[model samples]
Target: MNQPRPIFGTTIFDGSQARKGYALNRMCFSFNDAANRAAFKADEEGYMRSYALNEQQSAAVRGRDVLGLLAAGGNVYYLAKFAGILGLDVQDLGAQQTGMSKEEFKARLVRQNDQPAATAG
Candidate 1:
């Protein structure tokens, strides 16, 4: 069997991670509904418990630690629902992924955009 390759800074969401994150992803999926989102907002710990999230998953959620969530087997798509509840955007996630502040990430993006596109030889 082929082993999964390791990434330097983040976890790769694959079949194993999917199985590990099933409950967490399911709970995040529920956030698609306003009622469910409101319920989570009203009672964060209770909501997580109701979903049967593991300790690591619960801790990541509580810390708002995006990288930690990924390590805990979270899928970004499902996590996006949770992020929405926190009023975060993809840039915020990107910042976390790169270990930079949101403003730093945005500045990096701007700097990259200002670079001229490379041409094929």
Candidate 2:
């Protein structure tokens, strides 16, 4: 019997999600090729059509919403390529997920790095 999975506010990119996002992931993977990225930049709608993305995926791509993409079955790793097209790195996406501005997120990271580890007496 298949058990219902707990999603704790995040989509799990398991086999079912993989199948659901195959076309979307494939399209993002194509971005690894410069020409394909150029083609997408030239005509976003046309590029999406070639990939046969469903409405949800299409909207997510158009909005560049990391959470939206994840809800639309996007695997974060693959979606990183899509994010790159918008000049956003993983840190930017992490900030978006955490509702922090880029500078705030960077500062938080710096703070964590500067914190001293607890020592046992």
Q: Which candidate leads the pack in TM-score?
A: 1
Ten-residue segment with the worst summed lDDT in candidate 1?
Answer: 3-12
lDDT score for candidate 1 against the true structure: 0.95
Candidate 1 lDDT, 19-105, residue by residue in tens:
999999999999999999999999999999999999999999999998888888899999999999999999999998998999999
In candidate 1, position 22 carries an lDDT of: 93
**lDDT of each candidate versus the true structure:** 0.95, 0.90
Q: Tell me, by lDDT, which candidate is best.
A: 1
lDDT of 2 at 89: 93
RMSD of each: 1.6, 2.8
> Model 1 off-target regions past 4 Å?
1-5
Tens digits of per-residue lDDT for model 2, 12-85: 77898888888899999999999999999999999999999999999989988888888888889889998898
- lDDT computed for candidate 2: 0.90
